[model samples]
Target: MATRPLTGTKVFLILVAFFGVVIGVNVTMMKLAIATLPGTDVDSPYAAGLAYDREISAAQDQASRKWQVNAHIERRADGNAVLQVEARDASGQPLTGLKFAGRLERPTDKRADLAVGLAEAGIGIYRGNAASVAPGQWDLVIEGDAKGERVFLSRNRVILN
Candidate 1:
């Protein structure tokens, strides 16, 4: 059998092919990563930082109020979730005339968050429903507003089967 020597052209082609595959794979991976990435938690980090003091004061006020808030969530068979909230004062009297809202937030994906508008079902009792709630881990955020001011805020982690 006759043997041919390794030529400069062959070496150049081999090097180009090797680096081409590596670069191609890297570009594909980068595109996939950017496409799948969920954006920042807050739209403006600077603004959020500026509001840190207000959040702290609000939390202190909520604590001082010593309000009693209870939340119940039930996932129905039809992929909908029912949320019920009951608010009471420290003395156990029902709290009235307050607007309540709830959110089911996906910890990993902000786009999957579901907002629920709660209406007064009875004294101190509020009820809301969210459609097509996927069964998984979630952050349940409940907020209460009085006279257009945020008076209560709570976030609890929950899992649904």
Candidate 2:
């Protein structure tokens, strides 16, 4: 049997083919990473910085109010989530006439966030339902507004079975 002689052209072609495969794989991986990126948490970092003082002031106001708010989240057998909030003043009196809203946020993906519209169930009790909540970790954010102004805000991490 006669073996073909190793030539410069063969060596060059081998090198080119090896580098081409590496480059192709790298490009494919880069494109996949970019396509799957979840993006920034905030749209404008400068705007968020500008609002920092306002957020601090709001936090102070909320602290001064000394409101007692309790939130409950329950997963039903139908794979829905039920949220209930009970709010009270510092004096232990039920707070009334406030609009409450709830949100179930997925920590890893912002696109999976779910908004829940809560209605006043009683004097200080607010209830809302979210359909088809998947079993996983979630950030539950509950906000209370009075006369078009936000008065209470809370965020808690929860896990559903």
Report the lDDT tens digits of candidate 1 across residue range 1-161.
99999999999999999999999999999999999999999999999999999999999999999999999999998999999999999999999999999999999999899999999999999999999999999999999999999999999999976
Off by more than 4 A, model 1: 1-3
Where model 2 places Cα greater than 4 Å from the true spot, the runs are none
Query: What TM-score against the true fold does each predicted structure earn?
Result: 0.95, 0.93
For residues 2-87, what per-residue lDDT tens digits would candidate 2 score against the true structure?
A: 99999999999999999999999999999999998989999999999999998899889999999999999998889999999999
Candidate 1: Cα lDDT at 103: 99
Q: What is the C-alpha local distance difference test score of candidate 1?
A: 0.97
